[model samples]
Target chain A: IAGITQAPTSQILAAGRRMTLRCTQDMRHNAMYWYRQDLGLGLRLIHYSNTAGTTGKGEVPDGYSVSRANTDDFPLTLASAVPSQTSVYFCASSDGQGAEAFFGQGTRLTVV
Target chain B: TQLLEQSPQFLSIQEGENLTVYCNSSSVFSSLQWYRQEPGEGPVLLVTVVTGGEVKKLKRLTFQFGDARKDSSLHITAAQPGDTGLYLCAGWANNLFFGTGTRLTVIP
Candidate 1:
């Protein structure tokens, strides 16, 4: 089962452009998250959705936004990409709080 | 924000050798999780220790969580080359805070 899958495995976009990274899960999990990994900085949460119709800001939420329209998908958008946004993005989900999470392959975004 | 500090930022050793990686923090957590991630792949959970002073074993890997819930460790015995990956420890506060991963390279 493709537990979780992210679209646009890698992307290169010019600054000031808008882009959305797609994430989907087949497990029907209730919690979904977005995180970015930078060298030596660890993975920091960008945004998260506790369930459909509800979202919350995470540790690093500026420059990024997310929406959870249904249980299967939660997409992260960069309305105005910047060079500082170059990083690998990951999508994850859990059946519930404090549970084991499954992650997507990842989206490597380069904002030039 | 709660912070998790992992030690031995990098580790390289030959097969059959033993090594330990640590994750420490000043903030107590309700639960801590361990994940191993490879290049091009997202972090995958290896295990979770919720109880203070708890210990869990997965094959050759032994995981321990400090009673104070402020530290954790993973010890690998007779490590194999397949064990190479970035190991991370995460602490939870409603959401999880990941530590600087310990990159392990097991030489064959």
Candidate 2:
């Protein structure tokens, strides 16, 4: 059903560059989230959108931003990539708050 | 900030062995969820426990929520090579707070 689709499955970017990780879901979920997974440091929420046209900061919101223009799309952007930002980024969505969340395949980002 | 802590960050065992993983937190949660992630993939939900002291079983996996709803445990019996993956616990306190995750490797 293509529950969630993420673009640029893997990317290698130079520091100080701008990048956007695209995420789209067909489930029409109202809540979407962006998280980064690093070794020894599970998934840390970067940003979240309770519904379209609204967004909020998560645990690790620095250096990252997200926009939920509609129910199906929530994109996360890195204003200026840094080497420390290299990690696997995951996009997830749920029917509503506290519901089981389904995640995208993931975007492997490597900044040099 | 609410934090979920998972013990034994990594584990390796022979196939058919039994093992247990733990997830603990200082804050109480209305619900807790368990997820498993394999290489090059995102975490996928395995089960969710809503009530305190609830126990749920899924084939060889057994999940239990603490009476206080501040802790959880996952026990796998007769593990197989296919059971290898990263196990994560997430608690719902307004939002989901994920644990550090336990990486399990079952060798044949």
Candidate 3:
């Protein structure tokens, strides 16, 4: 299996700009998630989807948005980038709630 | 926010040595998982412990979940240089909450 793949492996943006991090999984999982990993900190959830069409806000969703249009894709959007939003973003998918979650390679974003 | 804490943030040891990494939480979870990641890559699942007081082994690595379902540990026996990477523990709350991660460096 191709497992999980994330787009724009790394990016640099100016403040107030917009960006979207893309994630796709071929595992056909029902739950998809977005998380941000900061230096020396644990992975913090940004958003999640229970299935193809449902999405929910997570711990750190203030400046981010997400969409789950199908079983294979989840895109996380940063509406207005800020320096505090600079972190590596990870995408994960699980077959069911509380099940094993497979993660994508993650996108390293830097907002200047 | 549900938090997963990992201990000994960083560890460095000789090739034949052993070490253990821990992940603890204050909330209950149905399942706990362990993952390993190298520089610039996504985490890869290592083991999943579902039952309370569960124990699972993957080669030289042993994984255990606390009886209360809020803690877990990963022990590596006779570590190798290839084991050098970031080890992370995760549990599902609303989604997956990853631990702070233990960066291990096994020297030859």
Candidate 4:
């Protein structure tokens, strides 16, 4: 069973462009999170959804937004990409708070 | 904001050598999790420690949570090339906070 899936395995976009990273999970988890990983910076949470129709900002949420329209999907959108946003984005889901999380194959994004 | 700090940002050692990585934080956590990520892939869960002073083992890897619930450690015995990856520790407060990470390379 595909636990979690992330789209656009890799992408390169010019600055000021718009991009949306798609994530879907079949585990029916109640909590989902988006994180960006960079060299020496580790993984920083960008956004999170507690459940369907509820989203919250994370440690790094300035240039990104997320929508949780349903329990199976959480999409992260960059209204206008910037060079600083170039990094590997990961999508994760857990059964509930403080539970072990399962991550998807990351999306490598390069904003030039 | 709670911050998790990992020691020895990078480690490279010969195969069969034993090593330990640490994850420390000033704030207490309800639970702690460890993950390993290889190149071109997302971090995969390794283990989770909930009770303070708990110790859990996975094959040759042993994980321990501090009695105060503010720190944790991962120890690998007789490391192999297949164990090379980025190791990260995450603490769960109201939300999960990740450490900077320790990149481990085991040379065969």
lDDT of 4 by residue, B1-106 (tens): 4289998799999999999999999999999999999888888889999999999999999999999999999999999999999999999987777999999999
- CA lDDT, candidate 4, residue B64: 100
For each candidate, the DockQ is 0.68, 0.71, 0.67, 0.70
For each candidate in the order shown, give its overall lDDT on alpha carbons: 0.93, 0.94, 0.89, 0.94
Rate residue B99 of model 1 by lDDT.
92
Q: At residue B23, what lDDT does model 4 achieve?
A: 95
Instruction: State the lDDT of candidate 3 residue by residue for B1-98, as single tens digits.
Output: 54889998999999999899989999888889898988888788898888999999999999999999999999999999999999999887667778
Task: Tell me chain A's TM-score in each of the predictions.
Answer: 0.98, 0.98, 0.97, 0.99
Worst 10 residues of 3 chain B by lDDT: B90-99
Candidate 2 lDDT score at position A85: 99
- Return the lDDT, model 2, position B81: 98
Q: What residue runs in model 3 are displaced by over 4 Å at the alpha carbon?
A: none
- Candidate 1's DockQ: 0.68
Weakest ten-residue segment in model 2 chain B by summed lDDT? B1-10
- The TM-score that candidate 3 achieves is 0.95
Q: What is the DockQ of the complex in model 4? A: 0.70
